[model samples]
Target: MEPTSDFDPARLARSLLRRSRQGALATLMPGTGDPYCSLVNLASHPDGSPILLISRLALHTKNILADGRVSLMLDERAEGDPLEGARVMLAGRAEEVTEAERELVRRRYLGAQPSAEVFVDFKDFSFFVIRPSGAHLVAGFGRIVDLKPGQFLTDLGGATPLLEAEAGAVAHMNEDHREAMNLYATRLLGADGADWICTGCDPDGMDMQAGRNALRLDFPERVTDGTGLRKMLVRLAGEARAKG
Candidate 1:
């Protein structure tokens, strides 16, 4: 799909907010004046800013309390061509959340990392919130969208033309095309009969169930007509056969 002149920061934020489970957090080590990094599971607040829960004793957590400056890099990790996926980096200031706000942060964090139940009991682990300074949103290969913290958070509720149309296109393809679906699954996705399911399709693309997750295909153009849809299916099949 061609890039839009106005990028939807909110849509991008929500996508990052929904799909990211792990991020690389970079924190400044106090005495040494160096940066330390660790992988952390994060969740976003309703306003779309990240809320980080950390064990007080964890090295990164300790560094944050001392210096407050932090950077987080989140990316989609599903198996695929890495160039096709999205990733974002958030620069923020971390602070130990206030006692009154702790419950909300705790709930959101635990919702994403249910297994944190085991470690939540540990006295050293607690919620630390990040108030972002800025964000860098990257969609697929070279599409980079940068925003100030306020703009990024505010845009989360705004609509994007492509995403809106893409949803509808995905619905149409999945509902109407079963033969092309099977061929794509068998040929491109390399999945056996029992493994495929038509998940959804929209003007911009289709999603098919492959193994335990769904594989997404973007349309060449805003595809509402049957001919455009057929061409998409054929393209997918050709790509699958070529790759195989």
Candidate 2:
């Protein structure tokens, strides 16, 4: 057999956060002291903080307003047996984002949930950020650990170059780089499909989606700007072509 890669739980946990764009959010019910769970679509800040767009009328949003304490659960949904894959319960307090950060957070949310554009600007809707304090990660059966925020989250080298360019990059790829995107999905990830599209990208890597399937591809280096992204894409495409 060929040599296996080294295991890094922290890195795996970070990837899980990156790939997960939606999860169940748990909040404390007002006056009841009971736990309330609701589904929430999420995006990540460059530093891996969870960003959410919710309406004031939402029960979960009301709960957050009543008590900022909350938890977001993201997990890998595998077929067959569900517990075989990894899952994370991130405990954090949700804070309503201020005006200065609204656009930044909005763009991030749209990058993950493009459909939110319809109701994103409603008068009752608002944006919130969940600052994770700790996490409980179960990476398969025997692999489990409790991690601090720093261990499971990444800083993205401090420059959010890709964040600003995310929308344009995704559009350019889908409109002009279909073949290359499909090649990356099949060659690099060994995914069994050809209809893949580049949905979003960040400093760490890019995500590809095809029907119900999703795949993540890492950059050769931490890329922040268009020049770095172009160079990396060119190299990856060339390598994919050669391998094909």
Candidate 3:
């Protein structure tokens, strides 16, 4: 079915992928080919793909090793009826992170799941990225649609500088700009005030959290470098403060 011009399935799907802290990860059991599902913590890659860190000894991890194909379910976790909230089921291959990409992946994961730092380096644990093949988003009666990767995933083509500078920028915000973070949440994003911190930033948006509650702040325009990020943030801060 065609989505109305006003409803954006891609944007909704991206928000779910970015904001969800945990998801129902489904993998195929080796011999029986049965579907095995487990609750797994998650984070987003700079390009908006889901990231998972799991123990090699775990059944779901073992299933992934046998068959890389998997499906992940993420939702808004809204109040009241769960079915009334938006959700997306993403189909993809969950491939282990290559050595070259480990550090970047690790930083992004830990940013979202800070407690995982305790055992992130354990021999049994490894990182995997779900390179999405497609997604099925169920928003409501007329909002159901299948989105191709291009429709939902952020294009990182010219965003290398932002990706490279993400860790430093995130640290800088958390360390030196707590007030601004609070403003972004309370004023810009309309989130309740708290000690919100920047988890990660990509070309498309910034991710933030205060305890378990998460928020996504989309950039007014894409940023690809440290300077662009700085200016865009300053602009956002101004806009947020103006709301006062």
Candidate 4:
């Protein structure tokens, strides 16, 4: 079925990508080419693609090594009937992270899954990024739609400086401006949680988390560097405070 006129498949898909902490990963088994699915913990790349850290010894990892083609299923985990909740199936090629991007990927991944720090550097574990070619989203009746990569992925063009400064900015927010984080979550995003922390930031928005609960705070306008991010955040904080 075609999506409703007002339904935003792209936005819903992006939200699932950023907020989901775990998903079902499907890979092709070697030779026979059978499908092997496993539960995996994941984090988002800055552009909203899934980043996975899997050990070489795992069956799914071995299958991925032989064939990179994969699909990931992420859902909103909404209350009530599970099947009634929104979910997206992302089809892509999972490739090992390039050396030049390893540090950045690692930081973003660890930011969302801090417990991963315990074994993030293990020799057997490697980071992989799913470069999505397409996605299928199912929200409900009249909300099923297919999306091209461009439809759901965040555009990173001209945002190199923002990426370079992301780690430091996230650190500053989590460390020094936690009250602001709480304010953004409760006031602006209408989410309730304690000890909310900044997990990552991109040109499009900031990701915040409190334990298993996560929220995405889209910027009023895109920001491209540390200065722009700071200003956008300050403005958002003021707006959030004004709501009280």
**TM-scores for all candidates?**
0.59, 0.87, 0.98, 0.98
Question: Using lDDT as the measure, what is the rank order of every candidate, best first?
Answer: 3, 4, 2, 1
**Selected candidate, larger lDDT, 2 vs 3:** 3
User: What are the runs in model 3 whose C-alpha is more than 4 Å off?
Assistant: none
**Model 2 worst lDDT run, 10 consecutive residues:** 1-10
**Backbone clashes in model 1, listed as residue pairs:** 10-155, 10-156, 55-125, 168-202, 169-201, 169-202, 169-203, 170-201, 170-202, 171-201
Compose the digit string of candidate 2's lDDT tens values, residues 35-56. Answer: 9999988877666778899999
| Candidate 3 lDDT by residue in tens digits, 69-183 | 9999998998999999999999999999999999999999998999999999999999999999999999887889999999999999988888889899999999999999999
Please identify which of the two predictions, 1 or 2, would achieve the higher TM-score against the true structure. Answer: 2
User: For candidate 3, what is the TM-score?
Assistant: 0.98
Error of 1 at 168 (Å): 31
Q: Write the per-residue lDDT of candidate 1 for residues 1-244, one digit (tens) a residue.
A: 4336666754565456444667899999899979899998776553456777788768888888789999988777646776576778889888777887776566655645657788875888777777888888777544677768766552323323433343345456556756566767676546575545444333544545544333444445655555555576677767766765
lDDT for each residue of candidate 4 in 1-244, tens digit (9 for 90 to 100) = 9888999899899999999999999999999999999999999999999999999999999999999999999999989998899999999999999999999999989888989999999999999999999999999999999999999899999999999999999999998999999999999998885899999999889998999888999987989899999999999999999999
Superposed Cα RMSD, model 2: 3.5
lDDT of 1 at 84: 72
